[model samples]
Structures are given as C-alpha cells and as structure tokens.
Target: GITLSGGQRQRLAIARALAVDPRILILDDATASVDATTEARIRLGLREAMKGRTTLIIAHRLSTIALADEIVVLDDGRIAARGTHDDLLETSVVYRDIYEHGLLERQFADAVEARGGRQPLEAAS
Candidate 1:
C-alpha cells in the first residue's frame, strides 16, 4: 500500500473515474488541492478524454470551468444563467464576479498581449 498526498489521491481518483470510460463524467472540485501547474496538466490530459462525452464539472475555479463549451451558473441549487463564457460575462453578474475578484483565471489575453504574444514560459526562461 502506498501513502498518497492529497493531490496524488485526487489524481488517482480522477484516473480511476476516467478509466471506466463512461459516457458521462461528473466532478466536484476534484482539483482543489492541486497546484496551478498540476491542475493545468490534469486539464490537458482530461481534455482528450472529454471529447464527445458529457462532463458535468462543478468547480468554483474559473480556469477549469472556462474550458466548457457552455457554462451553467448555478445559484442556490437553481440555474441562474447558462451561456458561453463571453455571453455569461455580459449577462450574468455572478459568473463575472468570479473573474473580477481575481480568485481564478486572470485576464490572460491582456497579459499575453502586454508581453507581445510570448508565452509565460518563454518570458521566464
């Protein structure tokens, strides 16, 4: 038996879920314990697995939710608004606040433009 850290356990759980290859997958804050880089890598791997499969991701992290083709904003167990990221930004105050508060997903495009299209990795090294 191997002792796993919180992030490692989370990754194992995700792998176990995906290994089943179900048509629909549901996640509830699955990556909360992981660092940004690890989360990004997990998202990259999951992206391929998610194709043509229905995924219900219940996440407060905007970066995770932003990848969805459509977003459903839930308020108090009811649907508050549903739309694309751009659409929700215009029409939903709740969804917009998640970004405005700087808790998740910065205005990455503006930051990238400021750096003249160079990636963060390129800028760092």
Candidate 2:
C-alpha cells in the first residue's frame, strides 16, 4: 500500500470503518485535514458507499458538513441547534458563525483568484 498523508489517513479510516458493513458510521471531524478538492472527492465516494448505511458526521468545517442530511450544532456541551443548512443558518448563531467563516474563506479564495492568482499580500503596497 502507498504511504498516506494525515488527510489521506483520515479518509482511509472512514473507508475502513465503512468496510465493516456497518449499519451506522460516526465520523468525528473526519475531513478536518483534507483540502476542499480532496474532501469533495471523499464525500462523493461516501455518498455511494453510504446508500444503505447511516452516517453521523462531526465537523467544524461547515463546507464539508453542509452535505449532511441534517446538522446538529453543539455549544458548551449542549445541543445549540439541529436542522438542515438553511434552517440552522436561520436559527442558530453558532452554526451561522461556522458557516460564515467558511463562506468568507471561499470568498477570499475567489477574490485572490480574481486577481490573476496573485495574493494580495504579494502585491506591492
């Protein structure tokens, strides 16, 4: 087998757990280490693999978590909110925070790309 990076290892763990033919699989921050592209690929694979299996994913990265069937936001050891992405965005401040952060990050990336791949910081003042 080929050597794997931290993110690859996490994806492999998910794959391995899936190999058990589980009725339910809980992923605690599983995609934290992977980049958006890799995470997207993994999630696509997961969709195919989880057809009949239940999946519970825990993630701080809202982008990855957005694909979930339902989202449960926790705050201070309490259940702050639970719902779909749109619902949580409307009713949950914590979920809003996480979602906004991901949005801002995406916007920043787009803006940088708009500048012909030159990072703003790399430009002369």
The whole-model lDDT of each prediction reads 0.85, 0.84
lDDT for model 2: 0.84
TM-score for every candidate vs. truth?
0.78, 0.82
**Model 2: which ten-residue window has the lowest total lDDT?**
116-125
RMSD of each: 6.7, 2.5
For candidate 2, write residues 94-114 as lDDT tens digits.
999988888888888888888
**C-alpha positional error of residue 123 in candidate 2 after TM-score superposition, expressed in Å:** 5.3
What shift in Å separates residue 66 of candidate 2 from its native position after superposition?
1.7
Best by TM-score: 2
CA lDDT of 70 in candidate 1?
95
Clashing pairs in 1: none
87 Cα displacement, candidate 2 (Å): 0.9
